[model samples]
Target: MMITSYADSALSLLPPVVAIVLAVVTRKVLLSLGLGIIAGVILLTDFSFTGAASHLVSTVTSLVWDDGALNAWNLQIIGFLVVLGVITALITVSGSARAFADWAHQRIRNKRDAKLMTMFLGCVVFIDDYFNSIVVGSIARPITDRYHISRAKLAYLLDSTAAPVCVISPVSSWGAYIIALIGGILTAHGFADTGHLSVFLQMVPMNFYAIFALLLLLCVAIFGLDIGPMRQHERNAQKGELFDESKGLPPGATADLPEADTGKIMGLFLPIFVLVAATIYFMVSTGADALAGEGLPFSVLGAFENTEVSESLFYGSLVGLVVTIALTMQQKISTSMMFTGIKVGAKSMLPAIYILLFAWTIASVIGELETGKYMASLATGNIPFALLPAVLFLLAGLTAFSTGTSWGTFGIMLPIAADMAMGSDSTMMLPMLAAVLSGAVFGDHCSPISDTTILSSTGASCHHLDHVMTQLPYAIIVAVISIVGYTVLGFSGSVAMGFITCSVLFVLAILGLKIATK
Candidate 1:
């Protein structure tokens, strides 16, 4: 309040972005984000370095105490990891996951189908990327191996779909995060214009990264349109030249080898079915405004529905888990085996959890430093109006790639993106923000130090370095298309144009690849 004049200079460097660069350099996400947060806190205050340190600690304590304000996506990150661990254990102990794998291996004809279906299944499970990663790997590994699809490709597809699909879907976990993110923006600006939550909601369909990458995955699947380095990797994978099976797999073991008694395949399916039913129920309850009408205020199960909407996905996961546990006994799997899968699954998310706490620390610290408002004014002053989206995208991409974390990117980027929209068309803001998100996803998709990258390598049983080298070329190819798509979108006069142009480029890209292969 006293020195609003210093806000811009104070925000010369964003905390998360710095952490991202540091993470890439050091390969330590937690360390980078923590340091950045500390720096941001120091910058915001007028006090000495010691005073800044004291201020950050005090602010963090206050924010953490609020519980509700510790970033809206907190539970989604925490619960998804824990639940996935439990689900994995249960699915494995029941031998049901193995049966699903056996069925997939039997049906797939070749390596293309193997990787393709893994990607397809990833899209289908779009509600949560974390869920998608563990579940797809849990379900598709066997089929991938039948055709000798490299574990690397399988992990890439899983990693690819995890964020891309969610960011695009209205009812997805990504959508939930964005809504909360933009809602905070609306609150900050004191704007009541329906907050353009719907604007961003609408723009998801137009997001180039989400639309194009998915289409690319499909082309890889159906038409066998492998190209650039991904094709070379796939070829090498088949020859066993760049990969080895003797490493004995890693991370949430791929469902490639059969451990289940096939006759009871249906027995293994109950947990998955139950989980899906619970997710749909959760999505509706939380995003229930769409279902609400002029007269319908309270749901029939108002207490249950109300509980779901208030507590994020954590409450629903609890309910879903209980149902899964109860059903497990009916399936007659030993309790010990289910617990084992849960432990394994939870362990898988450890890296993400580490990044999350550090990210939170940094964002809160930065916020205390008044860096967001500072950067906003500077960007408004110096950057051209037309170039804003591209700038935001580059910033977001750089942060994500360096930090090896999309959520951390969101923590840093969303606030500034939201600030850019103030006093603007809002329609412009939505696509611009979407561009930022896609850019971050693109960066994480290929970042070697990223958790998903590690998980993909582990899930596919591919050597980590090889997966990085092979998948990078394809990531770059799509990134170029996305850049052009976003640029065109920046100039687009209407949201519809943005949507159509992005969709066309993606579809054409898919079709073009198919046609060229023939």
Candidate 2:
């Protein structure tokens, strides 16, 4: 008899439990992760007793030594980081980010509209959070300030929308990752008939968190309902005390710097266009064989056959960095200033990168341990057959939230969730998979230590704590609605009907939010 909810399932969850406790106690992410990793090592030690240290040593060693170390996906993520560094360096040197502020200065009149526009900018980028934070923040900052919109709110809007919107959209790289992961899982579990992308698309409706959170953000933007810390930050910004979120900076301090970077703005925008064009072109050329080990060939479609979105951005950024630097020199920025930009960009980003690495490593550890089986067993044991879709939704959310990576969450839970859908005659799989994606995004949105959350704050140049504080209220509102939506979905009797109900409820909730906020 196969058992679910085995003791080992709890073992897999131990790391996150430790991380949260340590984060609470120390308030330092590095220390918290270090402690959590050490706890994992400790647990492995006890699991082996005499071979504990050896097992830990072997695991860490395998991370670097294993062929999986250079797996396409892992390399792609690392490559993306390199590109980010290069692009950020160029933006700072060219002062394009500053020029964007100057441009925004012309359009912004007051805080209310400033907040609204920030939300609009976040929605427009909808494909990737990485693009959302930096592109939107740098471009919109001036307008936000002109309207006396606090940096905190700017960060809130930017951070809030980035991950949530990406997870929900079908055309995004995010969409590809989750869909592909879930598809692979389903294939492993004997449901290999449906294409991964199609399965992923079907599930979008059930992803309550992503849908609901966006709903709340829209509502708040229109009506200006300040909830919790978000409201406090809004009030602070209105009084020109926005910069007060940081202990080190005085209010309106950037007012002193010769603040405009037209070149940086152009440089940033052009590269992004190039990157997107390259990504779309590659996706088209690759067809169905993407990430399936097709080697590079020079044919029009062949060039992109083996290429990934991460690779495209990585290469584009290398070109962009050189161009931005050359243009910066022509703009007569001193060599020292160029170097300073690199220093600042790198220094500012270290904490985020650290969090990314730790989060990635922890997720990797779970995969290595084959812990997903334990998790699946737990789900199968506790959830009723009829309510499987809703249960899958919760499982996906919990996994991603605990792991702090949406892709990883989908990868781990998809196989398990798909297997659970075996007895269902109704079309519940899509909703189940969507729940996985939406739930993962929800956790990533609020978690202070999540990579997207960290990046959004950094891009907005808002204090990290302030971004988390202000955005949490909006996140919670959507979560409440999403939870109700999912529970109703279990008994709604049909997928289409459930989706319609959810959509209507979401719309009404957003409208209600707008009315109350006003």
Candidate 3:
């Protein structure tokens, strides 16, 4: 199961490339992933057909169940998915979602308000991207649908805020991962005295993509700015066509909410409240062990620094599900009905679960191939210090796009970025680090193969490809601005001036996009 490195260069890239191409051409995520796995195994087995077939079987076995081993990361994620599915289904069956939608419909008069509110919800649930995407999508979809907003736009909002917000939030799951990576890197490079948390906070100002993305999304929602394919989708939505009917609504998406006088708004808000509270509490409790040696103060920040997010999400969601079921019982729902609803919800999530499993398997294949390591090695040659940030930005973006993961890219590139800065220019360290973080997010935002991307589509009930197409232009625009900002900051060595400049430029770009799209 341990694959350290690859002897063949061309073979390393073939797996992901094949996966990407197949997914795009066929629009079949599962098939594409399977083919990609087979191709990777074939290359790994020195092009022997029999060897490749056997390796593929073994890899799938380990990836799924792992030889009677109950403990597996893939299984953990799958369990989380099933629990989330049950929770969502229980909410829907209890008519809480319908009640909440009706309440939101009355308050939100226009598409602009609906979108802004959705964005607000996305911001509020910043603890984890997966949670944000699903919870926000579930709550906001009914409102957005009522206003004739395209599912593509909903997915974009969900996807953008999920990873982007989590990456920037100091206490989020994304923050924990980045801190661990940077901490290790800094320690190895003789910067052990500097706190990783401190370094991350310092880079916050220079995190142009995350900052700009937040502003841009808000502006776009408020200003009604629609451009590129998103514009067409918006136009169609205005005409009461949320999506092409031929494609049909995604699973878990309700085309119509039942008309009932019994549904209460509390049915919706109460479960969400419990879910959020439980998630935060679980994080603190699980992370309590991380603060064992620390004296007094009992820092909330410190607890977040060491929290096991996946475990927290799993347990927190289970608590939330149990609460939802209790509320359903209070509503006089039959036990059999609740069980049926759970089954329906889990079944609806089958597509998403399958895609997630395949994506993880492909990621494993690519990791074994050392594709990212090969790509990261390219940053070593002679390059101008001023352009180092820009180079790192582009490299990280490409690596994340190819790997379909930003966290994985961070693990691969942060050390290289840190080492490169340590060897040559120290001033370039923060900027280069920021570049890697931003670029990885940028790529993840746009990648069809990304887990967040799939989650967003599932949450919003939009077609997966539709979400990618609509969001790509926005991600690209922000990336271009981020590249420009990093390039200028690298040369000027002024984070404040560069940030202010980028902030203004981003707003202006939003304004221009508004006008041009109009």
Candidate models: Cα lDDT each: 0.62, 0.62, 0.81
Q: Give the per-residue lDDT of model 3 (tens digit) for 36-66.
A: 8888887777777998788777777777667
Roughly what TM-score does model 3 have, to 2 decimal places?
Answer: 0.94
Q: Which candidate is the best by TM-score?
A: 3
lDDT string for model 2 (138-244, tens) is 55665676666777777778877788777766566676566556656777767789666666666666677776676677666666667777666767777887655
**Model 2 CA deviation exceeding 4 Å by range:** 1-7, 47-86, 89-95, 181-200, 239-268, 271-307, 368-373, 463-466, 500-518
Tell me how far candidate 1 lies from the true structure as C-alpha RMSD in angstroms. 6.3
For each candidate in turn, the TM-score is: 0.69, 0.81, 0.94
* Ranked candidates, highest TM-score first: 3, 2, 1
C-alpha displacement of 144 in model 1, angstroms? 3.0
Error of 2 at 348 (Å): 2.1
Better of 1 and 3 by TM-score: 3
Q: List candidate 1 stretches off by more than 4 Å.
A: 1-76, 145-147, 176-205, 222-263, 286-312, 315-352, 362-378, 381-392, 395-475, 486-518
TM-score of 1: 0.69
